[model samples]
Each structure stands twice: as structure tokens, then as C-alpha cells.
Target: MDPRYFFFILFTLPTLLFGQINENGIKGYFSFDICEAVDTTDVIFSDYGGGVSGNIIRQAGAMNCVMDCSIRGNSFSMNGLDEQIVFFSGFQSVFNTSDFSIGFYFRPDPGVTKMNLFTKAEMCADSASFTIDYNPSSNQIEATLAQNSSIRTKVTGKLDPDRCWQHVTFVRDDRNSILYINGEQADLATASTRINAKNSSVLVLGSNLCIDRFRGLIDEIAIYDRAINANDVDDLFFHPEEIINRDTTIFLGGSVQIALSKNCADSYQWSPNAEINDATVAEPLISPTATATYQVDMISSDCTAKDEIMITVLDPDDLDCTEVFFPKAFTPNSDNLNDFFRINNPYTIDELISFEILDRWGSRVFFTDNPFEGWDGNFDGQVVNPGVLLYRVRFVCKGVEQTQVGSLTLIR
Candidate 1:
């Protein structure tokens, strides 16, 4: 066995070191590969700390096991029927803690109906018990942390079988007791005190007593005395080595391209439906006139993951739109150009406070509050005689208000 194949096998992603103990404070590790363990009972399950050697026992009979190297190199396979693996009176103090983390990778077979993944309890009572289990009916992984049986914090998302080969981690600390799936935090909340498995005389995996046998491949199971951060679990989930955040800044009317990585996801959905060039593709061009947050949901065969990028559109503050070239001609005859006495390029302006046109006698012939709209050679649905029109305009620029007076001729 090569020294680099420690922890069953090293699964690297783009030059990243996976399963580093000093980085995460790992205490107990179970890589169920017979070729990796030095001392074992019939070369079955071995611990990273060389302690699975003493915690081996059989309840009904020995479970027929096999080595599978398809996922992350190698894993222990179980038949979800009458197979059981019991542990002696060990692994008690390893789990007794107020803050701890348990992480592993597993793929469940269809025969696995309902079973607890990891636990150290005497019976059905939930007090000194810490366990993480799967519920087929809900299609979710639930965590019970030193629970009272009735109250447990749980986070659920649909786990289709195609996405079954996933990494899972559970943690309980002073601030939060969280469950992470595929490096994404999963538990929704059922909090309890520190676990009390110190006096538990029996411990087990795959199944308990006579039933609840798991049918799947499990690899790189670990127990830590301290809580690990989301990044640690993310590495366990085979997350990309680089931070996925693609946040950027842009001036008003400026656009940027954002893209998603193509590692394992099959489909994606982006939100708000604003100024995206192509919403269905892995990359899209966005040009927002205002600051906006864009959300994208990535769906794989087994799980759904989400991420977001905020586009900080440059503020239109301090922008001056006070200049308007009032045409000195007329033509409501509708030839399109210079047809109405209007402000040139009103679209460049942010807001129009007031715009009014008066006759020579100071009588208001046309009144408007829109910069784009102007007098169409009409006063109250009546065509006024062609003459010089007096106008007053007030507009806002960068939150500042300014006024301008101008005159124009209206031609028929």
C-alpha cells in the first residue's frame, strides 16, 4: 500500500489536499478497506487511528462484505438484509461532546428501507443518543443530536438515487447544530445539549441488533472532537478549489458575463428574469441599471445546490441631464423630425418635474410633466395658430433640481 493512499484513497480535485487531519481536527476515521488496515479481524473494517481492531463483534452472524473501488477509490459494501456489524464497549468517549462533527460518504441501495447511519445508544431512548439516519418516505437525511426522541433538528431536500453518492456532515456547537449535504448546509433545527455516550457499552455500524441493515457503499467515515467549518465539509463534498463567488461591479448600462462550473450538475435555473442575455445556459450576460442580486440554482442527479452573485450597478447620482436642445422649428404635420417643439434626447434625463408651454398672452396653452412628451401644435385638442411659444422646464439631475426657460416656433 502506497503511503499516499492513506485514508483508504486520496481523491484530489485540481491540486487540493483532501482529508487533512491537522486542518480539521479529525479523531476517529473508518476507511473500511481491508488492504489499508494493518491489524483486522478477517481484514474487515479498520479505523484510521488503529482502534477498529478492538471494537469488532458480531450480533447474528458475519455480514458478507466486499471491496468496491468505483467511488473515491474504495468503499465497503453491505447487503441491506440480515447483515450486522457490532462494536464492543468502545467509541463512547469519542462521541461524548458539546461540540463535535461527524462526516462520511455513502450510497444507499434500494433495499435500504429505514436505518440510522451512526449511533451510540442502548435502546430506543433518545437521551444520551447521537445519531444520523435516513428516512425513505421523506427522502431526506435527519440528524438527532443528544435528542429527547421527540425534538430533533432536521433539514430535508429531495435526494434522488442518482445523487445518492454524496458527502454528509453533522455538527453541534454552541451557536448552531448544522447538517451539511454535499458541502451545502442541509439541516433546517432541533437543538439539544452535549451528547452523553460515555457510558454506552455498545456501538455499531451498518445495522443494529437484528434489523435496519444498510445496503450501500460507505467510505472515509470520520469523527471529530470539534466542529468543522462549512469549507471543510465543502472540500469533503469535492467542491471546486476556487471560491465560486462571481460578484462584480459595473457602471450603469454596463454588462458582465457570469458562468457556472461544469463539474457534476445537469441543469440550472437563474432568478428574477431581469436583463439576462441567456438564462438557460451556464453563462449569461447581465446589464442592470440598478444594484441587483442574481440567484442561480444548480440541480444534479442527487441534490440541488444554490449560489448567488450581486451586481453593484454604478449609481446614477451626481449625473447632470440639464442640457436640452429645444428645436426652434415646427411641424405637427407629422413628418417625424422636429415635428413637435420638444426637449432633445429626454431619455438621457432621469426625471422631469415640470414642463409647460404658454401663449404670448401668458395663458398656459400646453402643460406636461413628462420630458419625452411635448406640445403637438395643439392646445386642449384644438390646433393653435403657428406662433412663438414660451416654455418653462424643470428637471432633476443626480437628485438636484434645475430650471430653464426657452422659446420655440410651431409651424403647421
Candidate 2:
């Protein structure tokens, strides 16, 4: 080939294969961000390495998963009788044999037994050509390939899937198959075989060969045609993303109204949400059933801030809502300190429908919708007589509507 032709071939190949291999060597990726989904019916996964799009097959079991706030994504749980994720070859070939690798993030639930995270095997084959899994009996991560009844290459890394997130990676060559957890090598062994693509070979996620399905959270799956290095793995682990820090407690099946930064943030958003009555306010209310992190995205004119508030919802019987305080009397004689009779636990009340003060004859004299406001001893424009006045406070607490009735003394 001519000198100019040689240079053209080198430059053109990478550009043509943009979806296959780039600087990072990623060919297929399923961040499972859930935010990237168009809907449940039209499942999709992006190809960050090769740029080729793929489809996810909800083979068996509900696609329900938990939002893993630790790494800012999702961890799918295959607890349903037969829940699993599959990528048919009709979507695209995501794995190859020579210098290939597969990886993902996972955290096993409590009492986990044996759980498989990723697999791609031909139907009716004795064993999957490729798979990465976690075995509680050994407290290790393992990879397997080749014929059925084949032994898995184990990598010893005793991780508490119920407590923290773990990143798992597998790099394959002609012989040794290396496994990594959170960018650190956990184990190494000579892989019995490399995965070969076939028409019947389909990609399975969160399950083991479509049997003995996994029951844990899995996310951020990717495949490469070449080996991924340790530095690259570390980079993948520490990639930049928005950070939100929070810790909150609520009654089981209860809600939380998180206060966003009121310092000029123009936009607000909440995610991994359920039972959300509003999302456009500085303080949106969320009621989550599980112990998960709630994220709020606050955007200002120039910058945006992301915050994560971890919510631990306990059983309804475990809560004790006892925030009640009020003064017995007040004198609105311009004496500032004792002029107003304010309501206690203002923040605890979800809605202060009304705070009413009535005369001895049951006539409403002073009224307010703001709980912070207090009576100023004025009925219309005139000061009321110095005597006992009735007050009725109506508010919602922890989803229960309540009413507080009492009397306060008014003095000149």
C-alpha cells in the first residue's frame, strides 16, 4: 500500500470501529441507571466501549431492583421465583474469546447462598461458556467457561454483599484468567476456556445459566474484546459523579420532607422515588418502604448541586410521634417576647390547615394558616378583652390528621 494509504487505514479503522474499542476498550455496557430507560417495555443498554446498542430481555421474574446509592446506580435483585436478565444475540455480540473480559458491580443480600451475576451460554449446554458469580459457602467470586460440568476459577475476596458494594472484573487470555474486586486482584487461575459467540449463546445477567437464579443487587455491567488493566479498573471505580450525603429516619410506610438548599437554587428534583406528592419544590416529600438513599438535584442559574439522603424506614409500631408544645397564655402588648403564642414542632406538621382563636361565644376572632404566626390579641382591628380564649389547631402528622383544642389567656 502507498504511504498515504497506510496512514489512512490506521486512522479510518478506529473511527469506523468507534463502538468496538476506544481509549477505554469498552465494547458493551449496561449501567442500569434506570434513568436511561424509555420505559419498562422498551429495555435498553448503551455500548460505551463499542458504541453498539443492545436490548435487555426480562426473561423470568419481575424487573424490580433497589437503587444502590453507594455507587450512584442500581443493583438488581433476582429474588422472584425466576427473575433473570438476558441479551439475545439478536441484540449484538457483547463478548469475544481472545483477550476478552467481563465485569459488573454487585452487593449480595443477607443470607445469600450461591448467586451468579453474569452468564452467556448456548441453550442446553452443560455449562455456560462465560459466567461470574459469588459463592457464600466460600465467600468468594468465581468465573467459569468451556464445557458443561466444568470447574469454576475462584477468586477469594470475602465481601459482605449485605453491607457494601463490590466491583468485580475478569480478564482472560490463552491461559490465566484474572479476577478483580474494586480494582484489586482477588484471585487468578488458568481459565478452562474463553467464551465463543454462537447463535444459541445468549447473555444472562443476575442469574446462573438460567437456573439457581441470583438474589442480589447487580449493576454497571460491561464487556470488552481486550483485557482491562488495573489502573483502568481503578479509574472505572472512581469515576466522577454527583455526590449527595444524608441520613434520615422515618416510620415504616411513613414519609420524609427533605429541605433543599434554599440559597438560590432555582430547580429541584428527587429520584428513586415512590409515593412522591411533589417534586418541583425546595422541600419535596418522599415515602420509601425500604432503606435506600433519596437523591435531590438542585440547579441554580450557574451550577447544580446533588445531595443524597439515606432514609431508614422502620415499622409503624416503632415510631413515637410526640412533638407537642404551646404556651398557656400570652400578652400582645408590644412586648415582643410574650406577644405571640407560636405553635411547637412547626416542621413536624405536614400541613397546617388552620390555627384559629375563638371568642367566648365561639366566634373566630384571629386566624392563620402559618403555624409560626401567633395571636396578637386583635379581633378585627380592636384589642380583645383580657380573658380566656379558645384555640383550635388542625394539622397532619405522619399521615394522620389531628386536631388540638385548648384555651389561652389574653391580657392587655
TM-score for each of the candidates: 0.48, 0.45
Q: Per-residue lDDT for 317-386 in model 2, tens only?
A: 4444445467888888895678887775464566788899898999999888896787778877988999
Where model 1 places Cα greater than 4 Å from the true spot, the runs are 1-24, 34-41, 44-47, 50-69, 87-90, 147-162, 188-199, 209-211, 239-412
Candidate 2 — worst ten consecutive residues by lDDT sum? Answer: 1-10
Q: Write the per-residue lDDT of candidate 1 for residues 1-412, one digit (tens) a residue.
A: 1111112222222223244434446555655544433443233433354233233332233333445332344566655554434444334565665567778877666543676676666666556566667767667887665545554444454554435466788876654578887778866453554434444545566555323756666676766667788767765664421115578766687997775543334676677767998776566777887889987766555455566788877655544475756877778987676667778757556788888888999999887888778778887788899888788888877678888898878777
Per-candidate total of colliding backbone pairs: 5, 13
Best by TM-score: 1
Task: Show pairs that collide, candidate 1.
Answer: 152-190, 153-189, 153-190, 155-188, 163-302
